[model samples]
Target chain A: MTESVLASWREGPVKQAIVDFVALATTPGPGFVAVADRIATFDNDGTLWVEQPLPPQFDFVFRRWAQEIKQDPSLAEQQPYKAIIARDPAFFAGVATQDPEVVGALLAAFARTWKGTTPEEFDAQVREWLQTVKQPKLGVPYIELVYKPMLELLDLLRAHEFRVFVCSGGGRDFMRVFAEETWGIFKENVIGTAAEYRYADGRIVRAEHALGSLNVGPGKPEHIFAQTGRLPALAGGNADVDIEMLEAARFSVLVSHDDEEREFAYTSGGEASLARAKELGWTVVSMKDDWITVF
Target chain B: MTESVLASWREGPVKQAIVDFVALATTPGPGFVAVADRIATFDNDGTLWVEQPLPPQFDFVFRRWAQEIKQDPSLAEQQPYKAIIARDPAFFAGVATQDPEVVGALLAAFARTWKGTTPEEFDAQVREWLQTVKQPKLGVPYIELVYKPMLELLDLLRAHEFRVFVCSGGGRDFMRVFAEETWGIFKENVIGTAAEYRYADGRIVRAEHALGSLNVGPGKPEHIFAQTGRLPALAGGNADVDIEMLEAARFSVLVSHDDEEREFAYTSGGEASLARAKELGWTVVSMKDDWITVF
Candidate 1:
């Protein structure tokens, strides 16, 4: 047999599903999809890279929030700000519980930090953070924490003429900074939540509010439609926030974090997604069994 | 010498400018752009296709408005609807004058017709309109009115590995319907003004309001940065609305409507752009002088 594109993946259901789908898509048969319709999208944070202890974007924002609080002590009393400053375990536990209130509070705080900057300035800030900051556990730049096997999957899809897009809940500009270098995806192919912008003084500057919806949960499919005018043929994600996106695709893959030694093992936030994968007969990839390496 | 990409174009400053810019971008020289950064954006209306008399989108909206008015005669008295229904030449004259109030009124009417429809439904509507409607003077479908020279330029740029995008002031979903077949550009590469969408009942439906800024004037560069995260290396346009987009690019080309024999000729809406083109030493392609063919 010819070598498989997903060489790092073991001989298992996960690898077999991908190989079979690609074969079906590329071969001249009833299931063949045209090259133009071969669009694939992946959830960025947990699916493509590390989103453990904290999402890298949250870490970046936390440092900024801490500095803001230090400069203006009065700001520390704000509910979410106070919780972040104190490292309140209860507040973080709420995040782990996937509490909507806590997540909204966190996003509100994150939005405030980069509200008024131009997109170019925001990208520059993100590039600086990516250069200086390292993931706490991995001790490497956040981009380096990307899963090796998943990267291979991305390449495999691209080899079959699929246009891969990184659809993330993270800031669109933040992901664009490193997407091209780390993922070999074009900046235009990175879709995420964005702040509104207005033209003033011969330049476009970011408005303090979001454009409309966040690129999470149902927003994923909404954005994919708004931006590309087509649903992805293949979609992958790792959490409940990505469930709607996966459902919109013809082939859905969910990554199960069950390998504590190689990666953080968690079944709390992604419980619904994991259950859905099983219920719908979607491909659920066990980190330990499906991949020979984590990063 | 080898055959030139723009063979139909008569040799002049405009043709030379395009040829020089492409050579500089592709060769190993001081201004050689990497393949990844070779982005070329074009304005959709007059720059790529006919916009005289009325933009083809306005024609589509006008028909929709007429249908809306017939169903609800009460709408006929509405300010913009009244103006459109009466076929008031003065009202359209204001559009040529770039009257903000008149343009805003027209857009408000246009939005009401398409809002609440799912993207798939919106695209289907646009596709139907394209099939049935033909430009009054051109006596051809709107898609066929696209400039033959511009089509050649797009193909040439694609051959050089430059990613070309259509940035328009028209509706995003409306353009995606025909961009792929008409221009040899994919739906994802077409960027324009978009309405906000909400996920409901397992499908995304357009919200009643626009997401943010219209993709016109300075909004062109802003939307380009927001969507693609990069400025265009080369840009083209034909009217004042596209001046800022051209200003944002490294190489700018403005198409002047001077071929009254073949295409409608007007220097009114585009006067400011023509003036700026002259002042900035930008390439201004005179339709009568520069091209041997109009369509």
Candidate 2:
């Protein structure tokens, strides 16, 4: 017998579903998907990696906001910056709940951090940040916090000729910096929300505003179609923002953050998605029940 | 000796440069790009197919506009639609010159024709159009009108493990319908101008306005970087619209439509690009001199 590709995953329904899907896709059978059509997409923040305490991207942006506030001092008076600097738990809770005003403030700050830099320069800044900063709760670099079982699943999908894509609500260019090294997914396959870019002085530079809709909620399917021109054959996510993306796929997998001891537990933002997964017969993988390892 | 991959291309400086570039990229040596970084972008219209008389996309749109005008004659009074309906040579001349007003009007009309349709429906319509609509001058279906030499070059690039992408000024969703069958490039690999999409009532629908910048001139590199997160390693184009795309690439190839007898001749729009190619020491493949076949 062939050794299991997702050895980190416990042998059960979740692992069985994944293996069965791969077999249906790869083997000579009635429902076999052609190699070109075997596209799989995974949500980045809470799905592929840890998003506990706060999203790693938001942490990165908050640190930059702190630096900006330190320089300008007056920036702390700004609506969002004031809340951020005050360490208001209510403000952080708003972000956790994905409240519109809070989310908009976060996106605005995120956009401003890398606005004028060329892609190369932005990438260098991200690399520098990755080297120096560690996740507050995980006590490791953000990249190292990615789930081991999920990484194995990505490899399993690739070995079966499925073209894997990292679909994220995080910054597109930001994800590209580590996607190739950490995820083994090519930069071209990383689709996410992007700031507008302009060509000036013989190089492309990120503009001050976003190019289009954020790659979350219904926007996920729209962006996916715009970039890849196909609905994913398989999709994975762990949050409400990813519900539409999962629904668009033929097979949907929802990762449940039910492991409090090994990994942080969360049922707040993803409640609706978790409920939908149950109603739709989508596979729900329990981190505590189905996985033996984290990171 | 192995037969040349680009046999349809004449043995000349242009052909030699391509072969040499592929060799350098594929062989283990200094400046050898790994397969992961071997990204090659191509302009669609005249570079890959016959774009003379009118761009095939314009032809597709104009036909739709005519149908729309027939249903509602008042549409014929609209600024651009009026010009298109009259077949005014000056209007076409303005388009050839890329007059901003004329081009904006054209894009607006193009966007409206397929707005509100699902991608699958848009694709089905495009497939139907391809079956019926033949290039006016060439008298062959648009798919078959693709350049034979360019097809050979694409195959050659793929053989060297270069990931080929069609970066076009045409509609992205429109091109995806034919890219797989016509260019042997996958749908995911074709990046082009895109309309905004909305998710409504469980299906993704094309929205009225463009999602971002038009993929022409400086917009090409901006869109390319936005989607792929990398500057193309190699690029090919045939017009001023493609100038910046070619400029952004490590190696640039300009296809000069200097052949009048076999293929339509055009030195008008592409003259500056042709001149820049010479000044920058970029490869210029003459349709008259280099290609033994056009389609």
Candidate 3:
């Protein structure tokens, strides 16, 4: 047989489930949704790209923080900087999995450090950082590590007329910088944790506090509904932070990073979500067995 | 010769300016913006529909508040309810014109009254209100008051691949109720002042607070950039609250309510915007002189 477009996904129940859901969602019948309501939201980190060792956003922001600390060593005395200086695993883990308190601390640090910068200025910095920094363990640019099977699934959804979006706990502007280029999705399709912005003297400048709560469990659906006036029809995610968003959708697919040989194997913060997925009949994708290729 | 599609607009500089801008934006040249960058935003109240005497959103919410006060006379002691009971013109004017403090009070009242309702419940209430309530002065449904000329302008913009959005100082949910059916734009295209929503027990519910700051003045461009990551290439508005958003665009149009015969004539809240339009050399549409029809 000719190679399936989803060649990276092995011929198994995981791949078949994805194909069947799209068929039912697109077919004209009781299961079919209207074109306007065909919103598909995916979590950014593990859902679409590798989140092992550290989520890409943290690598981006943490490096910026490290650079700022180099310029002014006294800043290293502060909470987040000090936590980084001490190398607190708990703090890092909390943010990686999107714990509200830990992420709130990082958000506060972001607001304080990036205050007074325009969106263009902040975006330039992110672009510059992406060009230079490599994913620590993989030794490649972070954008190069996007999951191949997930990209195929995004293509499949788009072919069926799904308006796909990335709903993540990572910074909204950060993801937006690479959304159109890396994911082949519209730049406006990203909904994530946001910073407060102020407009003055013709430029929209970033403010110190985040716009609202971080885009975690409940915040995901809240931001989705607030922006689009609808919950996602299809949702893909891989962590506890993504549970509520997955639950809110008509279809849920959770990615299990169970391939230690090809990718990191630990669930980290996804144990609860995996259990919940089993409890609820949400489809689970096994990286080790379901995917023939990891990246 | 065939009649122009924008027949509502009389042959004048105002009409020519709009046509010229769209042409330049679509033509492949230095002035030609990519289709992805062709964002057109319009204010909802006076820019899209009739807002004389009182804006329609207040009429909807105020009527509901009035009914609640009747059921519980204690509610009449509250500030917004008390002002409405007393027919306070200053309070109404401040809100219609989008005064930050005055609008903030009304938003606070909304949060207090509507907390714990899901998006579905709030939308149902708004849809029900639209069904029963008619614009008081016009004695017709509020949606019927949308300007024919403005609708023509929206259609022309969309024909040129412009993504038209309604960014209003009104409540987001209130506008979303009829956005798709009345405006022929996606419901997600409506961005307005937002209510904080909390997700719990398999349903996302509204909270007792507005999300972030009120969407007025600078909040307009802030919300636009936050949602779309780009500012408007073209914008239309008719009030002082819209001055900042109008100033941020490449082309700006301000509608002058100078037609008393066909429509109400008033610039109570639009005085500053009209002045800014003159100072900035922005196009000004005389409802009396430019339009062949009022509705």
Candidate 4:
């Protein structure tokens, strides 16, 4: 027999389940899914990459906020800036848990900071950052940190005629900058929280407001449906906020972070999610146990 | 010497313009657009199909309203229902011209009527209406009323590696019902005004509110950008509401209804569009003089 495409994934129930699901979905049987019906979506942050040091998007934004404070001292009066300056553990805990209120405040500030910028201008900055910004602990560029096993999974899905989409809580435009290059997903296939855009004088610019609500919890499925018009046949997520999207899928994979040596280990945000997965009989993947490699 | 793919189009500057634009776009020079940048969007109502007598969506909605008024009696007190009941000329005129206020109120009612329905339920109704309900004057189902020449244009654009999308003021779900079957465009390629969806019980349902503001004028380009992250390389439209979308495109086609016998010939709604087309030097297609066949 030819080697399995998921080389990084160890031969276990977790990997076997994914292989079997694809088998039933592709073969002509009760579980058979037509090409048009084969949709797979994944959460980006913790599921597909390292999110423990904080989600990459938050890091990307925090760097800019740090710089902005140097020029505008009064800006630290705001909730996000204040929290960042004080290194408040409670605020970081809220962020780690994907607290809706805290994330909403951050997104509001994010929208305001980039307002009036054209997509081309915004794209250039994101691309430049992706190539240069190193993960402090990893000492490598951030884009290099995208999980290898998840990419293999994405490939396996795509090879089976499944259209894969990256549904994230990150800014749509921001993720889109590196999505095509890093994940082989196209710009249109990346759905997330987005700035509401304005078109005037034959030009398009980012508006101050977000396009819709945050892409978390229920918003995942909401944004997914708005884009693809159907829930996924298979979905993968790792944190509490991804619970709703995972619940709505035919098969759910909840990645459990338990390998501190290879990758950071914590159940900080995904505590409830891990419990829910066990209760619902959803597949729980231990990063250290299931995968042969981390990066 | 090959017969043109746009066989329905008469030999004219309008046809020549399209032919020249495609050649330039594909020739790998200053005008050449890479496959990724070759996004083409079209306005669906008067541009892709007949919107007169009334746009097909309004007719579909009006029929449902007529039945509801009989059951509720008080529903007729509402603006859309009351306006439909009285067959108000001003309301009809407002709809024809794509007035934002009239469209917004009508969409508000549209969202409320189908509030808690699942996508499957809403899709069933739209598909049934498309198959069974005949256009009053056309003596055929509304789906059959889609313009053949415009369809040829879609095919031509696709044949040239352009990813064509249908961007309309109608509900996104509604357009998606027949998008692939009728236009050969996928469900995800349809962008339109839509319901805010709710997810619970592992099921997604349409919420009471519209997804965003009315998809007319600036909203068209905004919705298009929200989906694809960039403006169109080529675009086609037929009314005032499409002006912004068309204005943003590198190449724009403004279809003018001037064939009374072959097709309806009133530019009542497109007067401003026609004026803008002239001002912007947009290619204006006169149905009477340009197209050899209307359907």
What TM-score would every model get versus the actual structure? 0.94, 0.96, 0.95, 0.94
Q: Which of candidates 3 and 4 is the stronger one according to DockQ?
A: 3
Q: Worst ten-residue run, lDDT, model 1 chain A?
A: A92-101
Report the C-alpha lDDT of model 2 over A1-295, residue by residue, as the tens digit.
1676788988898899889988987888877888878889999998998887778877777788889999999989875899977878888767545688887887677666777788778788888888888877668888888999999999999988889999988888889999988999889999888888898667988787877877888878888888888889999999998999999888899999999888888798899999999999999999999997887
Please give the TM-score of chain B in predicted model 4.
Answer: 0.94
Tell me model 1's lDDT, rounded to 2 decimals: 0.85
Estimate the TM-score for candidate 1: 0.94
Per-residue accuracy of model 3 over B1-295 as CA lDDT, tens digit each: 1367688999989888988888889999868988888999999999999986777887888888988888899988877888999999888778646677777778778877798987778888888887888876778888788999999999999988999999998888889888888889877788998988888888888888788777789889998888888899999999999999999999999999998887789988889999999999899999999999989
Q: Compared with the true structure, what per-residue lDDT tens digits does model 4 show for residues A144-240? A: 8888999999999999999999999878889888887788877888999888888888788888877666788889999999998888889999999
CA lDDT of each candidate? 0.85, 0.86, 0.87, 0.87
Q: Give the TM-score of candidate 3.
A: 0.95
Write one digit per residue (lDDT tens) for candidate 1, span B1-295.
1476788788777888898899999999788999888999999899999997888998888888889889999998886889887889888777655578886886677567766877778778888999899888879988889898998889889989999999998888889988888988889999998887777666778777776677888888888877788889999999998988998888899999998889978987798999999898888998889998878
Q: After superposition, how far is residue B243 of candidate 3 from its true place, in Å?
A: 0.4
Q: Give chain A TM for each model in order.
A: 0.92, 0.93, 0.94, 0.95
Per-prediction interface RMSD?
A: 1.7, 1.1, 1.1, 1.0
Q: Write the per-residue lDDT of candidate 4 for residues B170-238, one digit (tens) a residue.
A: 878889888988999778899998888988888898887777666878998999889987789999999
- Going through the candidates in order, their DockQ values are 0.63, 0.80, 0.76, 0.75
Report the C-alpha displacement of residue B232, candidate 2, in angstroms.
1.1
Q: Could you say which candidate leads in DockQ? A: 2
Native contact fraction per model:
0.67, 0.80, 0.77, 0.69
Model 2: colliding residue pairs: none
> Model 1: per-residue lDDT, tens digit, A1-295?
2575777789987899988998898899977988888989999888998898878988888888889898988879886898987879798777545577887887677667766677778778888888899987778988788999999999999988999998988878788888898999999999998776766666677777766677888888888887788888999999998988998888899999888888788986798998889888889999889998889
Give one digit per residue, the lDDT tens place, for model 2 in B182-261.
Answer: 88988989988888888766788888888787788888898888888888889999998888999999899999988889
